[model samples]
Each structure stands twice: as C-alpha cells, then as structure tokens.
Target: MFDYSKLITGDMPGDKIQIGDSHIKRSDTVFPILLKKVKASGKTKIVISVYGGSGVGKSEIGSLLATRFRSNGYGAYVLSGDNYPYRIPAENDRERENRFRYGGLSAIAESDGFCSDWMDIVHDAWLSGADADPELAEKYEFMRDYQEAGKTALSAFLCTPEEIDFGLVNRIIKKFKHGEKQISLKRMGRAPEELYFESVDFSSTKILIIEWTHGNNSALEGVDFPVFLYSTPEQTLEHRISRARDKGVDSPFTSIVLEIEQQKLNEQAQTASITIGKDGELIV
Candidate 1:
C-alpha cells in the first residue's frame, strides 16, 4: 500500500525516529496531492515544507513523503531546520530560559503588582523551571503575571532571526532551485564543536522536503508547497512523553515553549498547502 524503499528521513545527525500508522496514513493523504502539484508546476526543483507543533511527527511524515516520491522515480531529500538554529541545543536552552526569566521579571517590576515578596517567589519558581506551570500559577497568583509576560517574550524570540539562521537556509534553497548539483548543507549538534557542513548530492533531487518545526516560518522562503501537520499541545505532550524525545520534554517550562510554538503554528497553518489534523484527517 506504501513505499519505504528509500530514505525519506531528514538529514539531521544522530536522530532516532519512529513512524507510526497515523503518520503513514497522513502522509498518504498529502503525497498524491503534492505529486500532482509537482507534476503540474513542471519545475525541475520543488521545495515542500512539513511543519507543525512539537512532536507532531513532521520529521516522520516528511520522510515518508520523500520516500514515496523517490520510489515513484523522483529524487528528494529531507532537510532539517533544527540544524539552522543560531545556537546549539544546550546553549539555546540557556538563552531561552534567560529570556523567559528576564522578560517575566521585567514586566512584573514595571507593573503596579510589583512586590518584592512575590518577585522572590516568582524568581524561585523560574529557577525550579515551574514558572509556567498552570497548576503553579493557579496555586500562586503571582506566577500568572510572570508566565504571561514570559510567553510574550518567547513569542518575540522563538523561530525569529535572533534564534534561527533563516538567511543561511534561504540561501541553500536558492542554490537548490538554481540548479546546484551538490550543496554544502549545515549540520549542528548539541556542542560548540559540532557545528559543521557536509556537501550533499542534489544532482538527482527534484523535490526538496524540509521537515522541521519552523518549516512554515515566514523567513523560510522558496517552499512551493507548505504542509502543516497539526497537533495540539496536549496531543504533542503525550507523543513527546512516549518518544522520550529529550530531557524536560514533559516539564512545565517545556510545555510553555510548546504552547508558544503552537500559537505560531496555528497562525502559519492558514497558509499551508496541506494541513492534517491530529486524527490523521485532512483539514486543508
């Protein structure tokens, strides 16, 4: 009923992935439509982005689509937007934490609700990485102010030029579309020394699949078809917990990040050429 005859997974280094029945079904929903568009466009090079909320299976579904495309006699590659972040995971985590704390405290200090006692409490909450916990906010009213302000600041920081190297990604897309045979693609790791690039053959590639959380991001140009795999934060949480994607994936602070990401994805999903719901049903 499907093809896994070739590699459709993203090129990110050191990734352990699992694709499920739902992902396959969703990919099947969109692949034929995408193929039709690719055929009609008559463009030698086409870029498709598979993006969605955290743990929504962008990487998994993108790979499946790519594999089907290749097995049907078209060349394709899945590029990871994760590798384009300005900082490594460890460094970026620290920066995001700093932003949340700073942004939250700054707002609280400026508001009439500024109380040294509450400020200290909020400070401690952030240190424990529970500032964004809904239960904590409900238990302690002061946390609500910090959580709101922190998420606002995160909206300004996440997936923007400050965090993601959109320019570099755009340039790579340009080269691919302009007939570059082999291109140097970036590879990033959790450490400083892990930043590097590898020359990859794009000579036979006709369709380029960028599977990432930020694939639908505004700064990422040149995507002829944008696909959004929609999943609510709660849904994503369950999946991430099962996958053991990373440390703190189930943490409240991480949940705050996922909330912010979902907000952005919802806004971006409007423009997606294809959108799949959590139930593996096509929404758009």
Candidate 2:
C-alpha cells in the first residue's frame, strides 16, 4: 500500500504508479517513479536474475536492463555467470584442448583485465588462508606442484584468435577455492583491490541483473517479482548474428557457432520470467 497523502502533500519521495505485466509502456514510467519512492524510503535492494544457457544473449539482456536502471540514477549491478574464479595459464590450456577436441574453438574461455583482477582476489583470499581446512590445503598444494607444466601449456593456447589465457585462470580458482591456504593480516595484509568492499549499498531501489551459470533457476529460487525472457533457439541465433554484425564481425563459422550458442540460451530463457511494472502492480 503506497501513501497517496504523501504525494498530494508534497511529502512523498516519489509517486508509485502500478503497471501491468504485459504493459511495456507503463513499465517505462512506473519503474523510475517507484525507484525514487523506494530510495526516498531508504529501501532499495532489488535483485533481478537473467539466467540462460551460454550464447543466449543473457549478458546482453542483463547489461541493457542494468543500463536502463542506471540511466534513472539507480546504482545498478551487472554480474555474469562466467565471472568464475578460474586459474590462469593452466585453465587456458585445458580449455584449448577441450575446444580442439570438440570440433573447433567455439566455446573458448574468457580472460580479460577484469577477469585477471578477479583472479587476483581469489588468489589473495587463498593466500590469506581464510578457508584452510587442512584437507583443502593439501589438495591445493598438490595442484601447485604442476603449475609450471600448466603454465607452459596455457602459454601455447593464447595463440588462437579468441584471445587471453584460461588455464592460469582455472588454476587460480582451483587453488583459491578447494586449495587450502591461510592468510592473515600479518601475512597478506590487505584484501585484493577488487574484493575490498564489504557489501553493496542498496539504500535506493537499485536494479541488479545477475547472470547465473546454473540457468538462473539456481539463483532465482525464492526471489520475488523475477522477470524471465522467452526467446527461441532460432531467435537467439538471429540475435547473435545481429549482434556480431553490429560489432562488425565477418566470420561465417563464428556466426554459425553463435547460432548454436543461441540454442543453448533458448533453453535457459524458457525457464525464467520478470516484473514489468512497479511493485508487480497492474497499471493497465
């Protein structure tokens, strides 16, 4: 129940206008207003998951939605499923080998500056020994023994057209996670540059678009007002093709692989839904 008196008396943070699910136009109006109201009340903490199989434009959709919220002066978060803490060099090699075996280099791993930064966080966390349970540490030490070999294999894998090192990423994640190391302020001092924040500030109704690896169902299990997109495999292919063309990519096979990826995405979207209006209201 919104306080109508607040709006009439110029005491409201913002007006709340309910919108219907099928009414896309109303969504455009109500969302921003409701955001203002939520922010005024200091109760902004919304999480909207956009999950689907790889290549299904999940990231694209999530990114766009986040952009929309940000444009309305909302602090939006755009997270991806692929943002896993993988080891570098070694992880790169393993991915290339797998890509090679699976006909071609379609499903390659991603390694960018952001990924490197995240890997550093995982490494720092491991070094801090935050999760050293003895058994995990023993396993991690064993993996470290083959670091040199893994690095070598990963180095060679970077020659492909896809770009970046994946093995080094995997090893980083493996050691940081299952691997057991204890880090103390005395030993490691501070947290990684990226992992410094204690928590996200959602005082204002901020929009968060999270792309989960486990088909969003895993992430949106109990979330309220979740919006799911329904795109078919063919539609996904067309979407990617359109994206590649927009990005100025002219490879035929690359386009084909993207199409296959679309099929995977269609599967994921079939299981998701979203809130189109303010407070899940029906504003015609």
What is the number of backbone collisions in each predicted candidate, taken in the order shown?
1, 35
Residues 1-284 of candidate 1 have per-residue lDDT tens digits of 66465556788888766878888889888989999999999899999999988778888888999999988899989998889998988889889988988888888788886688886777677677777788877886667777888888887998799999999999999999999998999998777898999999999999999988999898989999999998899998998898885788888888888888888889998899999887779895
Clashing pairs in 1: 8-63
Q: Give me the candidate number with maximum lDDT.
A: 1
TM-score of 2: 0.35
lDDT of 2 by residue, 19-48 (tens): 223223333433465455446655344555
- lDDT computed for candidate 1: 0.87
- Alpha-carbon lDDT, every model: 0.87, 0.37
TM match of model 1 to true structure? 0.94
Q: What is the lDDT of residue 33 in candidate 2?
A: 50
Which whole-number lDDT from 0 to 100 does residue 154 have in model 2?
35
